[model samples]
Structure formats: structure tokens, C-alpha cells
Target: MARDRSRRSARGNRLGLVIVGVVLLAAGLAALAVGRGLLGGDLAATPLLGDRTNAVLAQQWVPYVAVAVAFVAGFLALRWLMVQGMNDTVGRLYLARDEAGNVEMPESAARGALEQEVADYPGVRRARARLTESGDHPHLRLALTLEDDADVAGIWRRVRSEAITNLRGALELDQVPAVIRMSMTAPARNPRRSLA
Candidate 1:
């Protein structure tokens, strides 16, 4: 859920930036046209700052207000940048809750179990798993290193059918979204065969 929200937020941010960029571009073009006399307006003769605006800037509190606004904007920008590096990896999650109290499980246990299961598979050199979001609806990221001669498609199918299924059953979840990344290592040379 948190991952989805983050993605949506990123999308919205991009959309806002695009909109702002387009508006600024159009305004600049319009200003250029006016300055070139293409649009019947005397841009050079117009005062960049009006008398009323100058009076507001001349106030004693203006500098303080400007500094405060600058600080606030800087803080918000920093926060946004930090958020881009954030991940919603779950630490602990509630497996069950009732009058008997809540049954909690550390997310690392689940991740370890899943990794072990995959690593035990034939031809799989190594496996790693990460659980993200909430316990009720979690997302899994799996990374697998395989032997050069490993059956990639077969292993993929088996993981989707067995490993993920077992994880879902253990977590008592209806569905667990997962992403698997697989890579093959260089083939090992036969010891008995001498290099010519």
C-alpha cells in the first residue's frame, strides 16, 4: 500500500513539474513576442516593479518574511529529496488479531524463509528476498543468482507456483505481489580437462 502511494506521489510530482514547465515556457514566449513588438505592447517601457509592490517591499517586516519563506521552501525541497530515497520495507507485522490478542511476526523471518527456500532450489547459486508494505498486503522482491546451465524458465515457473504459494500460505494472505530478478554466473571449467 505504501509503495503504491509512493509511486502515485512520484507520478503526481512529475505531472506538476511538466505543467509548471509548460506554463513557464508559454509565458516566456509571450513576453518575448511582446518585447519584439509582435504583440502590440511596450515591454521595455513598462516598469518591472509597480509602485504598490515597491511600497510592500520597503516595509520593515518584508526581509524577515522573505527569509522565512525561503527557509520553508528549502526545508520542503530537502524533505522531497529525502523521500525519494525512502523505502517501505516492513520490519514487523501482525499475523492475527482477536480477543486473544495479536499474533505478530518479524518480517525478516519471512524473508529469510523465502530466501532459504529459493536458495535450496537446484541450480540456484543464491537467493535474497525483501518484504515491503504492510503484512496484510505485502510486496516481495526476490533476487536470484543462478548457475550458467540452470533452467531459468523452469525455475521461474516453480518459484511462482511453489515458493510464492508457500509464502502466501504461511502469511495467510490471499495474494502477495512479487518481483523476481535472476542472473546467471559464468560457467565453471571441468577440472579433469586440461587447458590446451
Candidate 2:
């Protein structure tokens, strides 16, 4: 589910970028054509800046406003870039609290344990996991690399029934939402078959 949402968000961003690019490209081409008198003689002959426009530009506040707008645009661009690199993984989890003290655990520890458990499965070649959202209501993201002839359905069942159950017990949480992604590698070559 998390992967689906991420994919959808990425698709939307790409679509928006393409639309903006096309609009800008068209506007640029139209401006170039008009400037070169390809669109029409009258439009090309018309001055880009009239006396009224020049008067507005001459105002003392105009430069300040332009600089402010540039700064805002720059800030937004930087923010967007930062968002692109953001991951859903969460940090330290607050486990329990009492008169003694509060227990805290690194998110990596939970993720590592889950990954190791899943990786130990018969057909899984590798496993990666991330704990997202708050510790109180955590979400799991697991990626598994499997052998070519591995039983995907069986592995999924074991992961849900055994691995996730263990994680939930360790976390002492009633429910833990999870999403799993799997990929298969090429089958191993048989030397005897090759010789035959």
C-alpha cells in the first residue's frame, strides 16, 4: 500500500512536470516566432514594453518585489528537492514508560530483526525492511529477493504468519500494517545437464 502510494505520487509529479514543460516550450516557441516576425508583422513590430509598463518598472518598490519573488521561488525549489530525497523510515521508537524509566529502541534494530528472519526463509535470497510512521502505530515495508523457482505464495504466507507475527510480538503491538515487494533471480545452471 505504501509502495502504491509512492508510485502514484511519483506518476503525478512526472505528469505535472511534463505538462509544465510542454506549456513552457510552446510559450517559448511562440515568443521566438513573434520576435522573428514569423507569427505576424504587426505583433513583431509592437514594442514589448510600453510607456506605462516602463513607468511601473521605474517604481522604487518594483525591484524589492521582484527580489522577494525570486527568493520565494528559490526556496520552494530547494524544498521540492529535499522532499524528493525524503524516506518514510522513522527513527527511535518510544516503547514503554514507567516510574523507573522509558524504554527506547532504534528503528534499525526492529528492521534488522525482521529482515534477518525473512532472509532465513528457504527460498529468499535477501530481505530488506523499514519501519515507517510513529512507533506507536508503525508500518512495515519489506522487500524480498527470491530464487527463480521459489514458491512466492508460500513465502508470503510464512512471512505474514511467522515473521510478521514475531515482529509484532517483539514490538508488543497488537497490529502492524505491512507491505511486501518481491523479485526473483535467474535459475541456477546445472552442470550435469550442460554436460549431457
Candidate 3:
């Protein structure tokens, strides 16, 4: 019922994406057929594309319009490709509290809060987190960037302790799975003084 609405099932969005993909796929096939001269020759039937007759459709504006449409298609295709590769993460984390009331927080919001808290430590440049669901369970994954001169071992230990305590404690969960990944910033090149 109403409580079920709180969790982000991802079903609706996933179905919507599937529909878009199918439409794009149909459009692509049509474009391919047109390009391959399947519609007879250099001329093609383009309803709403221009005039119905072939000779009238050969104006200079036609090719330019085609090019513009192609550019837009390319952008949409790129965005679709990116979306295909990324993990869908719109799930909400349900938090237990001392009171009997039900509480839920958006996964992105929790990640943002945790990322900011982790960035407070020295040597850590920044942090980003994501929450995703596996079956009925939720997991927190972290990506962190460190300064060139940062202490790896010490910073890692601190990060683990703080992440576990703050995250699990706030969520009121006895256990929360985490995945931590770290990357180091490249060292800055020193500018040499000119020798007079």
C-alpha cells in the first residue's frame, strides 16, 4: 500500500528506458535502410521531412536538416550508451529509530552526507558514495580521492572506522556492507626559476 510507495523499485524507470531504446532502435533501422538505398535510390520518401515529390525535396536545406537531426541523434545515442553502462541507484534506505514511526531516506542524500563527513579528515581530498540494492538488501559503496602526499595506511584506517560508525549508526542497522575505493591525485610539477 502506501508504505510500498516509499522504496524506489526502479521498475518504472527501467521499463521507460526500455521503451525509449526500442523506439531509438526502430529509428536507427529506418536510417540504416535509407542510407543503404533500400528505398530505391538516392531519393527517399520523407513524410514531414519536406515536400512529397523528389525534385522539390532536393533543396539545399534538406541535407543541412538531415545533418542537424543526425547530430541530435548522436547525442541521444551517446547518452543512452552511458545510461546502459551505469548501475541504477534510486533506491531509498529505510532507517530504524527508537520510536515506532517508519522512516526512510533517499540513497543519494545519505551518500552526500557521508561523503561530506569523510572529506573532513586530513589528506582526503574528497569522497563520493553510492547506495544500491541487491535483492532485498542495500549496500553503500564509496569512492575517495587522496592528495599526492597523503598517508595511505593511516587515512584508510580512519576512513573505515568513521564510515562504519557514522553510516551504520545513523541508519540504525546492525550491519551495513561497504565497498571502498581510493585514488591518489597526481603530483604537481614544480615551476623552475629562470637562471639569469
Candidate 4:
């Protein structure tokens, strides 16, 4: 998915560069025509204001140079804008690995650890965990499947408290926000069994 987004962003950058290039090329041609009097203008007189002919000729180079510089700057700006948009669109799809060696655990290992820690509580049938980033802090979200006869409010309170406690202890980070979401509640089983 990241690769796909990167490719799309690259394509957008290329398109923007092409547009800037075309604009610069057109501006260059216009500048040449205006400078050389090919656009049906007076050739002998000063093209610009003031009496400094040498300065005016030198200043004539400014428009072409400005167009080239503007083209490059505009292309870079458009590329940056497109890349930022792409990052925002796909940023939440994957978790960033922590740079700190101590916290650089495998994603599966972190999820498994969180799930095991949360599963010991009553009314929890199953649990899945994911680690995300909120600025510099690691954010954990746990989705718990509850038992059939469990009290939802009680389970939620217990799970939420237990999850925060365990995550803080394990990660040793007070900035973490551990969230518990109820994903499913199983249905009660029938006592009668049919033999076929």
C-alpha cells in the first residue's frame, strides 16, 4: 500500500514537473521574441524605462532567469504538497517502528504481549492489540471480544483499567493512551445437544 501511494505520488510529481517545464519553455520563447523585436516592436529604441541602455539589456535577462527559477521552485513545491497529501492518506495503514532499541520490538510480539496481558481478566473471550504513534508516544488500542453472559459496563471498566496499568508497566511510558474497545459479544450456548 505504501508502495502504491509512493508510485502515485511520484507520478503526480512528474506531472507537475512537466507542467512547470512547459510553462518555463513558453516563457523563454516569449522573452526571446520580446527581446529580439520579433513581436513587431521598435528594435533601435530602449525597451525598458530609464536611459541606461547597458543596464536595460542586462535587466532584460532577468525575466528569463526568473521564469527558470520559478519553474524549479514551483515544481518542488508541488512535489512536496503531493507527498504530504499521500502521507496523510496512507499514514494510518502501517505503524512506525520505534527508533529506540529497547522499544524496537516486533509488531507481532507487541500485539501478543498486549493480548496476553489483557486476556487474564474475566469476561474477555479474546483480545487483539495494535500499537500506533501519537507524536512521540506509542498509543495502544485493544479490541476485546466478550463472553456471552458478561456485564458489558463492568467488563469495559475492568478491561480499561487493567489495560492502562499493564501497558504502563510493560512499556514504562506514562504518555501512552491505552484504549479498550468491545469488538464482539458471544451468544449463550444451548444446553440441549442433538445427535445426528
- Candidate 2 residue lDDT tens string, 1-196: 6768989989998998999999999999999999999989999999999999999999999999999999999999899889889998889776886899979899989889889889989999999998997867789989999988899999999999999999889888888999899999976676356544
The digit string of per-residue lDDT tens for model 3 on 30-139 reads 88888777976755554426555667567879889989999999998898778657674656777654577757787877788889888988999989887766323567
Model 4 over residues 7-93: C-alpha lDDT tens digits?
797898789889989999999998888788887667524445666755765787788988999999999888888756642211222
RMSD of each: 5.1, 2.7, 11.0, 13.1
Q: Against the true structure, what is each candidate's TM-score?
A: 0.68, 0.87, 0.52, 0.42
Candidate 1 per-residue C-alpha lDDT over 78-148 given as tens digits, one digit per residue, 9 for 90 to 100? 99889878777888867898998988899989899999999999999999898987766788989999998
- lDDT sort, best first: 2, 1, 3, 4
Decide which is better by TM-score, 1 or 4: 1
Largest lDDT belongs to which candidate?
2
For this target, which candidate reaches the highest TM-score against the unseen true structure? 2
Clashes of each: 0, 0, 0, 0
The deviation in Å at residue 138 for candidate 2 is: 0.5
The reply for model 3, stretches above 4 Å from the true place, is 1-86, 96-101, 134-136, 191-196
Model 1: lDDT to the true structure:
0.89
State the RMSD for candidate 1.
5.1
In candidate 2, list every pair of residues with a backbone clash: none
